[model samples]
Target: MIRGVRGAITIQENSEKEIIQATDRLLHKMIDENQIMPEYVASVFISVTDDITDAFPAKVLRSLEGWSYVPVMCMKEISVSNALEKCIRVMMHVNTAKSQQEINHVYLEDAVVLRPDLASK
Candidate 1:
C-alpha cells in the first residue's frame, strides 16, 4: 500500500542554516518515527511559508546519504494573516505495509500548534 507521512517544523530565523537544520530535524524525526527507509519513499512534497525564502527545504534532503535518488519538490505556502511563520511542511509518499492509521505524523517546535490532533503527546 502507498501511504503518506506528514511533518512540519518552525524555524527561529530565515537564514539558510536555520532552514536546513530545521528541515533536517523534521525529516529525520518523521522517518525515524515511522521506520521509513529511503527506498520506500516514492516522493516528497515540501512547502514553506513566505518568511522562509532563504533556502528550499527539498534541496537540503539531497545531502542525506540515501535521499539523492528520492524525488522532491518545494513550493511556497499561501500567506495568511494569522498563519504560522517560518514554517516548513512536508508530505512524503511511500510504499508501506502499514495502514494509514498506523502512520506517524510529526510536528515540531512552533509548528506543533498547526496540527494539535496529530502532535505527539
Candidate 2:
C-alpha cells in the first residue's frame, strides 16, 4: 500500500538559514510521527509561498542521511490573496501499510492555521 503524509511550517523570513532549518524541523517531525523510512518514500513534493525565494526546501532532503535516492521536487505555491505567507508545504508519498486515517499530518508554527483539523493538539 501507499500513502501520503502532509506537513507544513512557516518561516519568519525568506532566508536560506531559516528556510532550511524550518524545513528540516517539519520533515523530521513528519517522519517521526509516521515512522517513515527514507527507503519507503516514493517521492516528496515541496511548495513554498511566492515570498520565499532564499532556498529550496528539497535541498534539506539531500542533506538527510539515507535520502540520497529519494526523489524530490520543489515548486512555488499558488498565489492567493490573504493566503498564508512564508509557508512551506510538503506532500510525501511513501509505501506503507497504514490506512489513510491512520496517517498523521503535521502542521507547525503559523502554518498550523492552514490545517487546524490536522494540527496537533
- Assess each prediction's global lDDT (C-alpha) against the native: 0.91, 0.94
Candidate achieving the largest lDDT: 2
Worst 10 residues of 2 by lDDT: 112-121
- Over 1-121, each residue of candidate 1 has an lDDT whose tens digit, in order, gives 8899999999999999999999999998998999989999999999999888888888778888888999999999998999999899999999999988899999999998998988863
Off by over 4 Å in 2: none
Residue-level lDDT tens digits of model 2 in 1-121: 9899999999998999999999999999999999999999999999999999999899999899999999999999999999999999999999999989899999999998998988964
Query: Where does candidate 1 have its weakest 10-residue lDDT segment?
Result: 112-121
Q: Cα RMSD (Å) per model? A: 1.0, 0.9
The C-alpha TM-scores of every prediction are: 0.95, 0.97
State how far residue 58 of model 2 sits from its true place (Å).
Answer: 0.7
